[model samples]
Target: MRTAALLGAILLIILGLAQGDSDALGDDQPMFDVRKVEIAGELKYSDPNALQQYYDQLLGSGLFDDSMGNLTNFVTRPPWIESAKVRRVWPHTIRVSVVEHRPLAYWNAGQIITAEGQIITPRRLPDLPLTKLMGPRDTESVVLDQFSLISQMLSTSSLRVAKLELEDRGAWNIQFSNGIRVALGRTDILDRLGRFVAVYKSDLSGRIERISSVDARYPHGVAVKWKLQE
Candidate 1:
């Protein structure tokens, strides 16, 4: 009984000494307090000042008390941030490295889609000349893939895709840079695109400005809608 009691007392004394050491460090070492934060990254859309505000709570905190994982998660909470890393620098500085998502095109309803098919909705959309792609819910990757294919198909031609839409019924529509719209119904989309390209090069390229819309759903040929005499 006496031996167990002595061991318990020794354990309490050891714990008390550890607590005292921690308290002493906190009180006597102002150099251990977080004094500066460094963020390094290529930020095209995200503001560095705004990102620094996330670490404001860590300021004046003892370097030992700050959690690196929590700091990293907070910096990566923004939609534009793809990944982030946080580390303590010596006695008083916290350093963070961040990677941001690169936008590929404008998605439905003011959202931006990245090359890897990530949809991000920032508070304010950026004004870029990128093509617009639209589709039903949960079909972002599908629409982006189709758009890429179509863009590649039309790469040799002078027509640039301004916008592409995949309707709920699976029909595809494309709007060209010159304000001409094309309808490719649910079937044989590539064949319709091919026919349009042939007809455009053979018959429509010279007077493209007068053409309003084209229906490429037919297998044999495409029907062109010309602008009014006005």
Candidate 2:
């Protein structure tokens, strides 16, 4: 009877040890099984549904592991989102916050320029009322920079550039809102622009109706193209 009691006690101890190991393994399980995911952002151009669906589907890929690097990379994959912040809310939730890019100018078929002159082609392009900028290949930043500087210089002037074009041959053409086009050759663009601005403010301000175009290729002065009367 004493031997039987001892064996029974040993079996009880073994069972208790097995149960404790099982509970410890359960404690190491995946952070409550990812019950919910939350994504928030000030989206001026992105579709909320698309973002939600994409992130929700990513749950199966183990993105719910609450890894900061994985979450950040997934959020920044969208073209409109310039940057993102990711966090794990603990227990069963993941959160992502994002910032959208501010469109500076219209670029090409589907691309747009940012204030920093970076080119981005988003998944969906929204129709924004902005000045059009066109240039040769790999000249997005150059054209954007020139547009910014010229726009600043013309802020006090009456004419506003509606379209700025840069050709492969290094020529520039600016069409103002008042239907006046200006041709600035490759070399000495800013100097020629300064000379033309002076001319517009002092001499051609009143006679704008009769002017058709302005050529600032001359070294010292600009050549005004006049609309001849019939």
For candidate 2, the 10 contiguous residues with the lowest summed lDDT are 24-33
TM-score for model 1? 0.81
lDDT of 2 by residue, 106-145 (tens): 8877888987677888787788778889998899888888
| Clashes by residue pair, model 2 | none
Assess candidate 2 and give its lDDT: 0.81
Model 2 vs. true fold: TM: 0.76
- Locate the minimum summed-lDDT window of 10 residues in model 1: 23-32
lDDT at position 151, candidate 1: 84
- Report per-prediction Cα RMSD to one decimal: 6.4, 8.2
Clashes of each: 0, 0
